[model samples]
Target: MTRRSATLAVAGALIVALVAVASFFNLPYVVYSPGPVEDTLGEWNGQQVIRVDGADTFPTEGVLDLTTVGVTSADAELDLLTALRAWLDPDRAVVPRELVYPEGTTAEQSRQQNAAMLANSQQNAEVAALRKLGYDVPEKVVVDAVVEGAPADGVLEPGDVVVSVDGTPVAAPEDVVDAVTAHEPGETVQFVVDRDGEQLTEDITTIAADDDGRALVGFQPTPGFDLPVDIQIGIDDRIGGPSAGMIFAVAIYDTLTPGALLDGKHIAGTGEITADGEVGPIGGIQQKIAAANHDGAELFLAPASNCDEAVEGNNGDMRVVPVETLDDAVTTIESFVAGDTEDLASCPAS
Candidate 1:
């Protein structure tokens, strides 16, 4: 062969090798895609998704779905080609790795945090649902976390339900903090807690807080409450997050109420719900919208903060309703079922 032709062939081979290597080069980004939409009123693995005891659950119709986003695990490596595809795809999202998994965080640590959040979200959902039904749920202080090398490290543990502090009954977390702050640094404070149905009292020394010149027990406490009825959510262990809290609360309320709230319409939504029924924003709003659309949902309830993404990423005919709280969601559903869409809040398209 001619020398010129031989050089051209070599150059072509080099180009092909470069493209192949680029296809396998891992990127430091994660991809978000549409996931499955699980109907909370339906069944999973031959069992009902939401089961209630100690109360008469009424028969309900229609769908109350919790939408989820398929996210790449923090430990999973993404290639350049996949990231490029996700960027170009309107239904998918490409996010920075650090945004999804913070620096110095391991995959196991992230999973454990998600699991803990899921547990707390379930408890909060129950509280919200019961309170919406006119049930009184008094809050109590519970130990959420213990700091290492702190005064309450070995003395207090997570899941310990605090009943009183310094011989005074503590009803709220702030009360516990106030009781501790009344003492001087290095002074011992008595704490009465119920651990796994057993009452125990322990004295822990107080430490000085760095932010304020107040005494602290070196433990994080959160508000908790007892439920009148037992509520069980039968979701897969792989799905762990607080994003489904709002949907879970709605499903529980529907199951306990007299009639069907959905009126045989398919609806899907995602948001973090607080005990006071506030709906909080979550990540991957676009992917969640796609999942609901793919599931044939006629209406999608999105957090008010996510209206921009929801409006931009919506490609189907499903109406995206903006909701700020659990009460807002229930009212929207009722109005939609009654065929009154003029008064409902919808995502504005600019």
Candidate 2:
């Protein structure tokens, strides 16, 4: 072959390699996709609580005691790319995607996503079911912190209505999630909140730094609630992650109560647990069930909406309980604990 032709071929191969690398790293803005239609149970105390049975409330810690958890922060595009790369290839080339976040994303977005993913997952569904008996629902907020390193350390707190972040006003909860996640951690962000009778301004530090050496602040601007049953609810769009909080609440309550909620049986679940006992469906239910199976849970409690995904993703060794109302969850737990037929049926499909 001619030298010129050989050179041209080499150039073509190089071009292809570059394109592959770029595609691997290139993160793009996903079209704004809204999740399931949440039927608004409406405004009592500015909370949108879906009244279901069997869910109970839990208490809150003075400061978030999350020594056992891990956290990361980045714009939406960056985060999505990070996940994709991890799923695709964790050790090879870091994808070349530009850090593009959903328009108007902020720190609040990261906090909410993380909270939803982690905190609520650790909670007990039966304890969450307790919220219904008291007629209480989850509270939504836009927070602005007025203090730091103390009780009001983060600007976003319980009962703060977030209007804008760093001058970007978000209209929906996802918007807030997207916005807060747009920045690197450790960046002090200004949040404008409508707190009760007046407007307040608060700044929260971003998450701790990642391996990339980006700044991160390990704080979430969440709202916690005090229930009639000595339970508390902690929720915030500012601390986006997952629903481990609700799960943690339930687990703690179960451990502290007389009989064990696990009943010497293994169980697993995934969902966003609101302070008001609402169990909202989450993404990747199939992955979560696989996680449960790995953990050896005999039963898997999943949101009714995500039941199909959980069943399809599961290996079928575990019984899947699709819970809707807090009451339904409690009944299931009681039945499981007593090893007796509570004569309970599955929650009505959402």
Candidate 3:
């Protein structure tokens, strides 16, 4: 070959080698970093997510809304991104974000950081609201226990209100969770509680950590409350988020009352119910319909606003009864449980 041709060939070979190296190394120029791949989306605080109570809103008491709400944080987002990257390419080296970490971080660290951030957000909201109302809302001691996994594992037990831990008084829910997590498993911890409005003391042994060496308490503290009306309302004051809680409360109330709203039939629904009896829309209407169908729910109830999504997503396989008000949800559920309408077509889809 000519000298000129030989020089061009060598240059081409060098270029190809560089490209290959970049791609294999996952160099920024060769393979662009993909944007956020969300495994789970956070809930919106001050926003209501609603669901209908049952198949037909007639017989069922009404819509059930979720009252617990959460706010988003930038740190939480970064933490999620870091987790996703670690999961996608564990062995690969990752450039640090805002934090200066010359050494690589473990998945556990990322998770803890995210949890602390979220807990802080929740604590801040609680504190600000409580202080505004001139009431003292004590921090709750949080324990995470697995059922059948440990002695402390179970839903927040009755009459368990955390007053202090290890002689250190906690003022925020996050503080309690942080303090409890400070100890390793198998350590005995002292907890001061206000049980049934009475001051009490208890010593509970922490359980062994699960697969992860992280200590497990086997139970979480459900925050106890001693507060004025404003503080009480503030805790429950998530905007548009109380629909499900309202519905559940109403259903329980209805069931406990002289007449029955369930009518002995399995009914399921989603919607937000206001304290004043207003019904609101909720997300995942289609997914919820699928869940109800899978569970053999006789009728599915959804908000009137979410009716379109439900109908479009279900493809006419399920009965989606839509309602505008909590009263409407109740009336519809009542009608269904009474066995008046057997045809699903009769109920309005949207």
Clashes of each: 0, 92, 41
Per-residue lDDT value at 93 in model 3: 26
Predicted structure 3: lDDT: 0.47
- Residue-level error in angstroms, candidate 2, position 181: 30
Error of 3 at 201 (Å): 34
Q: Model 1, stretches more than 4 Å misplaced? A: 1-15, 147-150, 181-184, 196-199, 207-215
TM-score of each: 0.90, 0.44, 0.34
User: Relative to the true structure, how large is the alpha-carbon lDDT of every model?
Assistant: 0.89, 0.48, 0.47
Candidate 1 is scored at a TM of 0.90
Candidate 1 on 167-247: residue-level lDDT in tens? 999998899988999999889999999999999999998888898868988999998898888899888777888999999
Give candidate 2's whole-model lDDT.
0.48
Error of 1 at 342 (Å): 1.9
Q: Model 1: which ten-residue window has the lowest total lDDT?
A: 308-317
**By TM-score, who's the top model here?**
1
Could you arrange the candidates by TM-score from highest to lowest?
Answer: 1, 2, 3
User: Is candidate 1 or 2 superior in TM-score?
Assistant: 1
Q: Judged by lDDT, which candidate is best?
A: 1
Evaluation by lDDT, superior candidate among 1 and 3? 1
116-189 per-residue lDDT for model 2 (tens digits) = 55444433332454443333544444332333553235435655676777788755555555566677665676
